[model samples]
Target chain A: MAASGEEVRNMQVILKDYVAGFPKESDMNVKTGSIKLKLAEDESSDSAVLVKNLYLSCDPYMRGRMTNSPVDDPDFSPFTPGSPIVGHGVAENLRNSSKFTLLMCPFPYYTGILGMPGMTAYFGFYQVCSPKKGERVYISAASGAVGQLVGQFAKLMGCYVVGSAGSKEKVELLKSKFGFDDAFNYKEEHDLVAALKRYFPEGIDIYFENVGGKMLDAVLLNMRFHGRIAACGMISQYNLQQPEGIQNITTVVFKRIRLEGFIIFDYFDQYPKFLDFVLPYIREGKIVYVEDITEGLERGPSALIGLFSGRNVGKQVVKVTNE
Target chain B: MAASGEEVRNMQVILKDYVAGFPKESDMNVKTGSIKLKLAEDESSDSAVLVKNLYLSCDPYMRGRMTNSPVDDPDFSPFTPGSPIVGHGVAENLRNSSKFTLLMCPFPYYTGILGMPGMTAYFGFYQVCSPKKGERVYISAASGAVGQLVGQFAKLMGCYVVGSAGSKEKVELLKSKFGFDDAFNYKEEHDLVAALKRYFPEGIDIYFENVGGKMLDAVLLNMRFHGRIAACGMISQYNLQQPEGIQNITTVVFKRIRLEGFIIFDYFDQYPKFLDFVLPYIREGKIVYVEDITEGLERGPSALIGLFSGRNVGKQVVKVTNE
Candidate 1:
């Protein structure tokens, strides 16, 4: 068999080494591997698609999988030594097999907005938070994929939406681009509890928790009686050996607060419902989508690692191939 | 105005100093005090009741109130220096005011059961946990005031009930007296999680979390999908500088668990509803009530401190008067 360029091969970024504290650029390396593009014709195996990876989503959860461990981590599984590092990514059908099939979606910009980042925000806000009209909603890490969508959804529901981001640029995007009721740069704010009180003097009813640790503790103090906290992610404490100490756990009982953590996979069955709700917003320009794309599959390692450092402003995506 | 020879002065315990670490017996002291038996008709307060306490219930939460700077505390208010230690106690109405008229009940024991601990278990289980019939229920610190009642109520609801206690005596009491399906001495069990798994191989549906820290972390691993955890008390962590780190918080999302905390004061309106349910159990002897009474007002401080050390088995009560 002659080795051709188009031959079936598994292209992946392997974990060169385990990470401690902050993961550097050199921790990951892109390497080429091989895989069967075709599947067995046995009736037991269903049709599957061999996808050429397009837009890859860079998220905080990826950092958790970078560590080497003897025991399985409760948060996420440890990354294999010599496998393609997998995160949520948009792809096109390179080859169709018995088990899976794929699609070639709209333009490049539309890919990420319709991809993992968009889906995460769409379902996370509606289903997990269960927002209502005239409710007060707060979003932490507001300019990110899930936060940006959550803020917009809250606004669509006729809610008073306030957001907190790490940088002033992201804060401006939250207000100008996303049309949030109010936005603040958490880095600039001396006290988070005071900041929340300034924006929401009446008290916050629903909180989309994106950054856990001290922020969560402060939010607990500011929550109104019977407040709902949809804990989407904890970017701040994901890579730490020990996450931040929670002092305000008692507030859950006293103020009757409900804090719930969620994953988008649970609500994947409701994808059609999500598309039905969000597609119109995208079409009507009601929902503005933003993407920070780092070009090339070789850059996948850095893009994923950059999530913890607040490098990408909006939805962080690595452009694997221009389908 | 002449004092009777047989009349013993109202001697009560006071917070001698602010607690630093685990509260010591010397942190609180008994002080002899006097009060007027009668008040004038034009008294400033009408709703106040002058009651001679017959029985005082020693509770774990009292330890939390002993500190001076409990401003951040979510549950009960902190105790003031030089003041009589106020807690859940059965008292006789020696003098009546409109505010305290609620204490004038036909059966005083009814108030104790229906007042705080009874209501704690009622709302904590039903409202917080939202327990369904036949769901597997596990209670920690069983044979205590709230735990025993929770186990009994769960059993009545046709749920599989298991409880954990520190002593063999309490374990026997939980199984035979309280009608629990199984009970274990946590002190005797080398592995808490393994012990729980042995009793509940199918996994726990509802865990009434009384003792937090390691116990809570263990139960998190054993919880079934969509499990409910009523965070009633983290008695183990109350006195410590820092509570134990729960490494299994990731299970909260994976298992779709609902962890909620609640106080009894919120369920005060349900007192009548609680009595209607519990009175029959008391009369039919379906519910077993145990009281460990320490005689004399001087011993009250010791009784209160004993709760943290697990020195008292059942509802630890101090007998202040013969009546």
Candidate 2:
């Protein structure tokens, strides 16, 4: 560690160029640059805090940042070519007194269960779905970060929970590890609509949508009357230049379905309440969280890209640097 | 009019065949059928009430019934080819003490303003949209039964309302008659998304979706953060075997939008409350309902088909027999 006001070598994962379709590892490069360490005078200092990024979140939403068009939120703006990529990350203030105190859970898990993804699962399921006991629930990308948690939450509510994942292992994880009532490998299913019909003969009452496109179309076709769909993310669609159209959208009207999309940024106020609800679940071993971690900042691009192809088993995170 | 236990000739609109694409007048034929008129001992009697049909409603949803595939609800099941077409109609008990009392509004208006259409507008705008005062609202198929009421409801809440219709006459009606803040002819605009952007420069806060397909795709792009879409009906998509896909649905996630589809049948219990709310509005001239009344039962096919082609100016109703 460099002393205060001393010149030091800093490492960052830089976006080499703007991405068009599926992002490759060549799109980013790990580079070392010089930085001068400085301590801020007060807690609310105007100057930037020199933070040692402990963990970097590899989320699918980051794919929008890699594109040419800027996202609406300035915080999630387009990643400039030849500049550092930005996303949710766990960082400790190295200049002075550290600011973070994640007492309830391990700091590393902040990139997965204890962070934005956690809040997303909590609110998206409870608030948006308005889930009732004994209701049928289905989750797409079932073994992933948000999907797994939602499936568990549905199970907790006495719901008949079914999930779909791309790989056999993820499907098994959803059933055995996450306690989903039934799980299937979406890749193996030739007819998704028929598959859903088989799993949910009564029809799905609530669908936690993650992978949008054909999956969404199938889910729409299988939804029961007065069904609710909580749309959190669409990883499969992120890399596409022109997203595939959802053909069975008319079913939403006929079946009287409610499809609601929510961003975690809007529900940050509920974080404290979410922590109160989920902390006990985590402590009691009721809610189990899985993660796929990659070491070093250099692997950030590949880790994030893995999300599009369903390469990541769970929450994908990169360990930037040790405290 | 027929007396008790009397055999009489009944004029009826019969479905000649199941419809495939857009419904034509040839799909239905006016026929005269024989019926035995009778009266029940009590109001709750199991025997059917022999009544003279006064008015028959011509709604776009009726198109679904004309298809070979039976809709989910048994009440809205597929129309049997070569059988009498069934729909909402204003009738009076001709064989006994007349079971009819519409003191607040005209009995004929029950086919449109004072009944299902009014209730659809009430719940869809207030409950589904959760509209606030001064929010921007947009309505597609704005000159129709439900759309016109939704527009007026938004205006009553002090919202800035814009409407889109298929004709120049309807555009003028939306602005001058229905009191929409701004109105446009969607058929004139080659680029719907750009047209919506022009009208809703600040982005649409509420979208009362009636016409679906590409229009819904355009509305999806122009919605504001935390926008609400009350999907009452999708008139444009019902005729197609394969409904057009909805692209740009991902904006719902980034913008935290809520899109809810509702059936008026689900809100039937709220009729008395709806009457209390809308009756005053009608009496005070705050809410004006327009009707396009066709004179004879034989014209039912043409009147009903006109809804799909946007040939009718307002709520299309066929006066079956004068009360």
Quick one: best TM-score, which candidate? 2
List the global CA lDDT of all models.
Answer: 0.76, 0.88
RMSD of 1: 5.4
The prediction achieving the highest lDDT against the true structure is 2
Query: Could you give the CAPRI-style class of model 2?
Result: high
Candidate 1 lDDT over A76-127, as tens digits, reads: 6777766657676655544432323232335444445665556667776776
Tell me the TM-score of candidate 2's A chain: 0.94
lDDT of model 2 at residue A5?
A: 75
User: Which lDDT tens digits does candidate 1 get at residues B1-323?
Assistant: 12223244677788876776787778888888665455444434655445667767777777777876544335567888767677777665544422243434433354245557778888888788888898999999888888988998898889999999999899999988989999999998878889989999989999998888888888988988778888788888788776566666655654667777777777788778887887777768787666677888788878788888888877777787774
lDDT string for model 2 (B1-323, tens) is 45566888788888988999999988888888888765666645646567778888988888988887756798678988988888997987664565667675676689888877888888999999999999999999989988899999999999999999999999999999999999999999999999999999989999999988999999999899899999999999989988898888888888889998998999888889888888888989999988899998989999999999999998998988664
Cα RMSD for predicted model 2: 2.3
